[model samples]
Structures are given as structure tokens and as C-alpha cells.
Target: MGADSGFDMVPRLSQGNQDRREWERFLEGVKQYYADDEQVEVGPRVIQFKAGEWPSLPMEGHKFLRFSSKITGATAAKTGVENYIREVQELAKAVFGGRIRPWNELFDVWGFYRWDFVHATMKLHNLVGTPLESPAVWLVLPSRKDIATPEPIPLTSVNNQGNTDLYEVMAIPGRGKGLVAKVDIPKGTQIICEKPLFTLRSSAPPSMHHLVAEKLKLLPNDKQREFLSLHNNFPGQYAFAGIMRTNALPCGPGSSVGGIYSTICLINHSCIPNAHNNWNEEAQHETIHATRNILAGEEILISYANEPSQARQRKLRESFGFQCSCELCSQPLQAIQASDKRRADIEQLDETIGNPVAMMSSPQKSLAACHDLIHVLDQEYGGTVIALLARLYYDAFQICVAHGDQARASVFAERSYMSRVECEGEDSPVTQKVKGLMRDPTKHPSFSAYSTRWRSTRTARPRNVDANSFDKWLWKLSG
Candidate 1:
């Protein structure tokens, strides 16, 4: 059968691909600005500006002379937000050689100008700010009309799943500001869904300081105070960068974009975190969900690394200018040693399970290795490892379907869907695909790849089997 044999239930564009397409569209939209006489870099440009210095126009003309007074260091600092808009208007003329037009006027233009990138693309609006010495260009992706946008649970809706009122911000000892549950939060409950205060490019230029400063200035006075209140480990000249480094969260699958959130950034780090953070592309927000039941008064924590041992986690924490004394890090020396060994074994099993040669020659052994890795992760990290668990279960589901074990594939696919819904949102493409597989495992692309060996109906659960016995049977565990 062909790869497209299934009902095509899954969304075609992955988050990574969507981002790339948006960037390409942005490049195409801005291509007209590049002069035929002068060679300009094709992609995003990183230009550096000195403190209180305005960006030099890429396209120069006599029209720029009018803005000379406003662009100077002494006058730029004295200008208020109102004057800043006029400055941007003048700068836009200079940058585009009077060819710059409103976004609606630009026929192919799509995407909102994120506040942080307003300085780079001088489209004047209420949220606009002055240009930085080295303005960083940000390409915002146009919203996909084909995919249904997932609505987040309203903050005030009491009956909604994962109500926002369940948690509160408080000062915890040792850890500065941390989120705490006011009441018990069950697994998969959404804790927070907040749009970022600003989204910055990871490869930002040195003039990012000025860009950040300009963005902050554009905020209301109250928001400006709130932003300044966040933790800043880097205390010297570039205070803005310091605060950003301490609080920025990854915005997507790739590291190209980093976002700052006032509330989510307050959640502290733990080697064994009870909560997990996810970037919801559909909602365009950073979401936090309880990976396990979190008791009242318990501090919310999320892991900072993928698979950092205790020692490595400690080292990673030092960059935040503090040492972690979480449950995992506070264990006895012998316990820590045992935990490290378990983590090492989990890594080894992961590698073995992914080996193509092992899968072809010893499929059973490969499946068993995945089971072992899941067990180790559960024992060590508990529900905090739900993301990894979801991936592993999906792998097992694929293996079972490929070898024609519809019964096992159905169970694994159900598990994968539940775990993915808990980790990613229920609307996620992975979760939706797994849901379809649970309904009809034979529809999987790899279902006919190998001859039927352990074929059975999708509903082949043993009657009267206890929960423990069912799990053992599902995993093919020996007595």
C-alpha cells in the first residue's frame, strides 16, 4: 500500500514546516525592498545599534535627512512614546526609500507585527516602538485557515476543565516566585495558558538590548512595572538580556524563537517536576498542565533539561544563579547513585529500541527494550515523563501494527493517544492520529509492511482480567 492509504486524518504541516513556510512567505513579501543595484542578504538580517542610536537605513536617499534630528542619541532618549511613533514613521521612509506602505496596502503581506519586532519593520501602530541600532527581523506566520483553532479554557469559566483559579502565585523559600495549587489539580488539568509578553528570535543581534528596551517602553505603565519585577540573574549593563535569559521559555519545537511569560516564567525548575510545559501552536500560547495530581500548597515545577543527571541538572541550575534542592536532588548519596544508573539504563534502552538493524533482526527484543525504557522512566520520573511515554507508546503501537497484531496495536494506540493528550493538547495532530489508529489499527501506513504473525481483532481484551493482569498482558510481560 502507499503512504497515503489512510484517511489522511493527521494535519499535513508539522509545526516546524509551518514556521518555515511562514518565514518563506515573509521573505517573499519583503523581496521588493531589496534594490537591484545593491546586493542585500536574502534572509533575516541582524543589524547592531549602539545604545540610544537609531538604525541606519538599508536603502538610502535624500528623504532620510528629515529624520536626522530625531535619530540622535540625546534626542532619542528624551522622546516619549508619542514622539516615538513619528520617529518610526520617518525611519520607515528612510529604510524603504519612501516605498513602505501600510500592511493592508502591501498585497502579499500577512502576519501581525509582534511588538518586539516593531522596530525592525517600521509599520506604525499603537503597539509600535522606535528602531533599535541593530533591529532583529521577526517573521510572524499567518494563521492557518484550514486547521480549526483550538480554543483555550476561559480563565473565568469555573466549570471549564483546568480552570485558571486552581493555582496562585506565591513566594517560596529559596525559590523566588513560584506557582502553587490553591486546590488539588488532577492529571492533565491545564494550569496556565498565557500569550508571551514578547517573542524574540534566538539569533538576535547585540542591539537586542535596545529592541527589548523599546518593546518594554511601548507597554502600559502597569505592565512595564510587572515586567521589571521578574527575576534577573544578570545584573549589570544589559539588565534586559539578563531578565530574558532567566525567564525566556522555548516557544516551539525548534529553538529559533524564545518567549517571555509573566506567570509561566515564575514556575520553578525541578529534576522531577510534577508539571510540564507545552507550546500550543494552534492557540499560539505557552500552556502548563499537571502531569500528575498536584496537592494544594505544593510548588509547581518543570524540568529544565531533557535527560540531565542530578549533577548535570545542578550545573544547569547554576546558570540561573541558584542550586536546586528538589526531592530528586536532595536524595541520599546512594539513592542518587541508583537513580543515575536507572537514567543511564533508560538512555541505553532508548538507543537500542531505535536501532533499525535490531528492529529488523530482533523485533521482539526491540519491543521489550521499549517496555523496559517505559518502566524505568515511570519508576524514576513518574508522570513527569508523560511526553517521553507518549512517544514510546506510539513507537510500540507502530511496531505492533507493522507485525499485524491489531489487538496489541489497539491497546498501545489508546495509551499513546491518552498520554499525548495529557502532554500535548487533545487537539494536537499526534493525539488525533493515535485516536484514529485506536479505532482502526489496520489503517496505519505500516500495517501491511510485514506478514501477519499475531493477528487478532482490535477488541481482543481478555474477559474478567484484573487491571494489573491486563497491563502485563498488554506489555507481553512474563510471569
Candidate 2:
């Protein structure tokens, strides 16, 4: 092997050669190894390059050898390649569905892309992985230097001939001019629907006066006034800043910055909300749906809690300087006190129910304890019971399958899959694994002694039972 051969094996990692002395040393080593390459020691073993195999190298000191060659010129991994294909499919669907079909015309006429780059990036991230908690992601897009800026979308307003129930703005105490109900709002009702008045995605913060002023300049005179009238704590400042502080609903990922809505901002806050603010990309609409029956003259409310709970509800309301007086909060003191006691009981029971020691001698007692906690939670929250049930069922499924109780394990597996699908969506890998168990419970290698306690033919109610007796039975069965 020549000195040139030594230079070819440069110590530099990737790209092209640049340094001179390092390159020279690499040339010397390459030449020496080339001359007697079969005996060139790399730790405990010699490398025979011609055979393209390295002898098993022993661990140095206590360090384990983990070596994998970096593939040259590879920009993405196999998962990345699969993701690209998935993205292409989504784009194809969007185009065929007409969401992207007018992109050329839309961009040419408006001078800016329909969807900003930041939101696009966020959507891509969500497509790949599921975060343990919240699903929203934040993205910032570059502002355009060219093209005339579009006018701000207007807040929905009253029309004389038609009932302006959807458009009428009401003054909410603490929070300013919130939209109020002129009529009864039914469950799943879409109260307000309007485009974003104007959106700013950049990190740069401007004074409220400046932001509102800029938005006003883009809109017609009447719409401008409506936008200005929206609830904002800081009235002296620009309408934009004030509205943001008062009425902005979080539309972005992970609840970072609050987003302003032209019409939806008027909806009030409730611990137990009748209405839910939701986004529909297909319709290009931000909608409010009633979760339960809302009466005439009652204020439509949306829960500010990312997760529905009394504690989180209070925190959100306090942050905005208002005490929520929703129906739940307006309930009798005794009822509220009972609810708090139940919550505390559940909290305490949580630790003991899952403890292995508690079940050491009597598995029945352990499952019984878990059942009691779950029943209490279920009474307080309807479908929320499914989330805890899913987890408990999965644990029991593993135990049942381990003990070769295929029928019992299969029942738990089905329950696990159903709950997972309802909470996390059917597409999630968590749901997929549970679905696999549903298919073949006993086939799982985990099926053995661990499942013995949960295995029972009487999975449901036993004989004639009263409400309290039935509850007791549930506890004992689960234990």
C-alpha cells in the first residue's frame, strides 16, 4: 500500500478533506495498515479489510462496544422515508379534496400562502409522534416582505332582518364584552363561526395599540369598530392587545400564546362548559359546540381546562382574574363539599389500590379496592371512567393471560382496546397493542401465573343486587 492509500483513510468524519496535518497523519497510518492490514489492531482484535469483517472486539475496561457505520450521503432514516410517503399521500388527498387545488390561484390572488409554514411544520410533527399529554404544537412562520397585506376578517355582527343571536355581543363581568345567548343554544350547536380577524405568529411583541391599529387599518370602518369593541382588559392600549388578553382562545399547539377569534372571543368561561370551541380545517371554521343542554338566556361557556377538572378550571379562571360561576360552581355547598371529599378519597385510595403488598395475601381485596376508587370517579365523571378502566383492564389482562385464563384476558383486552380508542384515537400504537391482545390473548408470552387473580367466569353482576350491594360486588370482583 502506498502513502496515497494512507491519505485516503483520513481521520476526518465526513464531507471533503480540508485540514493538512491531520490528513498527513491519516495517510501514514493508512499506509502502515495497508502494508500489513490483516494485523492492524483496533483494540483487542485485528481488522482484515479485504474480508470486510472485524473480529469480535472485547469490552475495554467496563465499556460495551456499540458500533454502527454512518451511511454516507443519507439525509433521512427509514422512518423518515415512511413519513415522507405518508405526507405525500395526505397532500394528494388534500389536492383531490380541493383544499390544495386552488393553492396557485389563492397564492397568486392573495400574494401569500393560504397556510403559514409554522402551522405546516406543527402538523407534520403531530403526524409522526404522540406526546404523553397535550397535543398542540407551536410554530413560527417568516413574514412576507412583498405583496399587499390582506384585510382583517370581521367579527360577526347583528343583521336587522334576522335574529342576531349569533352576532350580539354581551358585556361579561370581569371579562369585558363577551358574546351572550339571545336564544337557547342546543347541544352540539355551533354558536359563532368566523375567520381569524388577523393573525401574528412572530415572537416579536408590539404594544396593544399598535397591533389593534394595524388590524383596524386592514378592515372596513364598521368591522374595525366591532373588533375594537371586543372584551380587552387594557382598553387604553390598542384593541389587539386588549382583545388578546381578554378573549383569545388557545388554537395553537401546547397552549403557548392565546389566539384571538373574531366572533368566538365573546364566549364566557365555565368550569362545567356547555359549549366546546373546536377547529374544523375542512370547513375553515372555528366552531363552538354545546356539550350538554343549554337553556335560553343562559351564557354559553367553554372550559379553559386542557383537561377537565375542578382544580385546572379554577387555575384558568384565576389567571384571567375571574371566579367561574358556572352551574357546577353554583351548586349547593353540601354537594360541592361531598364532591371534594370524594376527590380526596380517590387520591388516597390511588396509592393503596396499586400496591403489590396490599394484594400479597388477598388478591380479592386488592382488586376490590381498585374497583371502589373507579366507581367513585365514574359517578363524578361519566366516560372519564373509561380512561382508568382501560389502564386497570390492561393490568388485569396481563395477569389473566399470564395465568392462561384466555377468556378473562380476552375480555380485559377488549375493554383496554375500546378505552384506548376512545381516549387516544384508534391510530395510536397504544391502541394497536391492545387490539393485538384482543386478537390472541393467550398467545401472548406474558400469559402465566401473574394473571391468576383476575381470571373469573363471572365478569359481570352476580344475582339480584341493590345499588350499594352491586357496588360492593364490583369492588370484590375487580380485587
Candidate 3:
């Protein structure tokens, strides 16, 4: 049942103005709400709200709550207050067992804190590994039941024309731990689909330290050991926090949270990486795919930073405490200068094509610039920039379709769809929409808005023309 306030109340630290009594009242409110449930047993240090069968929250049916006294702010300095807090904690432990002890210990070390309790309709689970050998807490919120219980994808299976077991963990010369292709991996092949060991909020509060430590204590012995053994570049008193910062990848669509995967973290960074890692929300997994064909023994690399610019990438990687000596960063001065020039040109063209006035005034020029941008990106990053290429093709598709150039629009849409499927999986919404547009360009949101100046049918295709001639015709490029 919903709270009497019609909203969940989570305790928070009041500003300097709020007195201790206000905090006490807030604590009492939380206790009363949980106590109201006959199935829930409130103890001095912990509270256990049993999982109910009926739907109480938004879209979720079953719900469970386990709160520990470690969440309280009582201290030894406040004699009576400390006794009250201990009583609450002991009561919780009596009903739920000593699981709250570790949580309480962490709280003692990291000060007490509270978070706002919001209704979560989805089934949320804290995924853990063997007691001693795990990464961190992985909070799984699956929109569908199937996503929560994903089918086991074989590591060696040749499904979707990819061998997931193509890579092996190895120590690289400069990089500490890196993935090396055990077999020749072709472009667009799914390399790995790793479920996170644990996940944390993207913008967690300082009190997250205690929360994480508590979660770590809940892991099986082996899992906790594995988590503690993880590499932490940012060494400090709170080692768990450092490990999280070093290896967690963005999890959800908004990237408001992060997840840690054991095997995926082994792959190191490169400005011009041969592979890319994507968070597949639909499948509830993190997928790694080869951006280009990788030869056996070649180290697998992925860009650590989203910025395509080399200078920015170098600066960004520095925060991770490592100098990237990848091909792009370690290139000769002459080669670097040339690459930088091309990158600058690509940025300028991207700006021009994005400008509404430039597009309206000279659509043809903007289209040409898009082509130029693609050429430079291809020359610089090869198939690794397939995601960028897809966007460029979609832009061209929109422009051509708007001007009633159905033939070119169809071709661009096809190109866009293929590239998107190669980068993001076919199940992706963007890829699916582009696939539909390839079949019928007229179905596009911007069908023929501007003019029918270069009108052509969706069936238009070059016949008997050489590959070079076909490309020229497709882009309407001059000799």
C-alpha cells in the first residue's frame, strides 16, 4: 500500500538551521511506514519488509525492503540517542540476522546518511557473484522479464556471425591488462556481452562509500575477494571507491549511473580503437563489438573518452593516470599534423552542415560538405567511426528526402541503416527506423518538405555502371 502522504519519504541531512528534533521526527516517520506492514518486522538495528505478491509500486508487482541501523546518525557522544539507535539496530538484526553488522560498521566509518525513497515499478535486483570474487554491486532494473533472465549467449557460439570467445586477457607491454584477439575477428562482430558485477548511481553522494561497502560485505566470500583485488589507480583510504571510479562504465540510457564488468574492464584505451563498447539497454548487457577486422594477437582497444579530437583525448586520458601510446597518439609529428588538419576540416564541415542557414541557403554545398566529412572520418578512423558515418548518412538522407531526391535518399537511408546495424545492434531503434526508411523513403518523417527539384524513385539503382561511377552517381559528385 502507498504511504499516507501519497509519496515515499527518504531522510536527508537538514541544513544548519534544522535541529536534532526535526531529524528524529523524520526517522520516526520512516519507522512508522514500515511498521504499518504486518509482514515487516522492525528491530533496533534493521527492518525487514518481506516481498509482497501484489503490485504496490508503479509498474512493479513484488516489493521488498531491508533497512539497517547503520543508516541512523546516533553517536556515543549523545548517550540516550546512541542507546535508541542501538535498540533500533538490534531489533532489526534480531528479525533479519547479523547482516546489518557490516552495514553498521561501514556507517560508523563513513558517517550516517539517507536518500529519498522513490517508487520503482521495475524489478530491481542487486546482482552479486561468489562471496569473495566479484566486482561491485550491479543493480538490474529490467523493463521486461526476459531481459532480467537473459538467455545464455555461448562464448564460442557463432551466432550473428561472431565468435564471442575471440579474445583472451593478456598483459600488454605498456598497458597493464588488455584483451588480445585469440582469432581473427571480423568487423561488426559482437566480441562480448558482459553483465555488470555491480552498479552505482552516476552522481552518488559522499555517503555512497558506506552504501558500497555494505553491498560488498553482502557478496559471497570469493566474490568480495575478487572485488577487493580489482585495480585501483586512485589509491586512497577508501579503496572501493577508487576501484569503482577506475573501472565502472556508463549503464543506463541517460548514463546517470555506472556498472562494473569483470572481463570488459580488461580492455584498455586507444584514441583510434579497433573496437567499441556499447551499453545495450534492451538486452540489459554491455556489448563489445569489433569496429574493424582485427588480426590474431592484436590487442583489443576502445576509446576511453567520447571526444574524437586527439588533443582532448590525450588530456582526458591523463585523469586516468596513463599516457596513451596508441597508434593515433604515438604517430610521427608529420603524420600527427596531417591527421590533426583532417580532423579540423571534419569539425568545420560538421559545423557547416549543422547550420540551419547554411543548409537552407546552399543545400547542395551542405550535402557536399557532408560527403567531405565522411571522407575525412573514413580516412582518419576507418570503420571504427561507423557510428559517426551512420549519423552523416542519416543527415544526407534527411536532406535528400526533404528536396525530393528519393533515389539518393533511398541509397543514403540504406547506407545509414547498414552502418548503424554494424555499430549498434539491429535491435536498436535507430537501426530499425533506418531499415524501414530503406524500404520506403516516402515513409520518412521529412518526406518532401523543401522541393521536388531532384525527384527520383526509391527503386533507382545504378546498372552496368562500375563501382567508381556508381558512387559518383550516388553522391552526385563531379569529375
Off by over 4 Å in 2: 1-186, 202-216, 234-239, 281-284, 305-318, 330-335, 341-479
Q: Which residue pairs overlap in candidate 1's backbone? A: 47-134, 48-133, 48-134, 49-133, 49-134
Largest lDDT belongs to which candidate? 1
Tens digits of per-residue lDDT for model 1, 226-280: 6677777667787876676666776654334567776787777777888777777
**TM-score, predicted candidate 1 vs. hidden true structure:** 0.63
Alpha-carbon deviation at 156 in model 3, angstroms: 24
Candidate 1 yields a Cα-based lDDT of: 0.59
Error at 212, model 3, angstroms: 3.6
| 1-479 per-residue lDDT for model 2 (tens digits) | 00000000111122222223222332334435345444333432222222111211111211111111111123223223223223322432321221111111212221111123322432443322111122223121111101111111112122111235643666656555555667776544556555655553222235545755776698777666656666444455344665555555533222222445556665666544555554432344455555445676666666554233467546654545456566656778887766667667766665555443343344555555566766776665443334455666665554445545666567667877876554434544556777887877755654543435555442433557686765445444433
Q: What is candidate 2's CA lDDT for residue 358?
A: 41
Give candidate 2's TM-score. Answer: 0.41
Q: After the best TM-score superposition of candidate 1, give how far the Cα of residue 3 lies from its true spot, in angstroms.
A: 30
Candidate 3 — number of clashing residue pairs?
33
Per-residue lDDT for 239-311 in model 3, tens only? 6776776667766332435666667767777768787677766666788778899999998887765444566
Task: Give the TM-score comparing model 3 with the true structure, all chains together.
Answer: 0.61
Best-first order by lDDT: 1, 3, 2
Per-model CA lDDT versus the true structure: 0.59, 0.44, 0.57
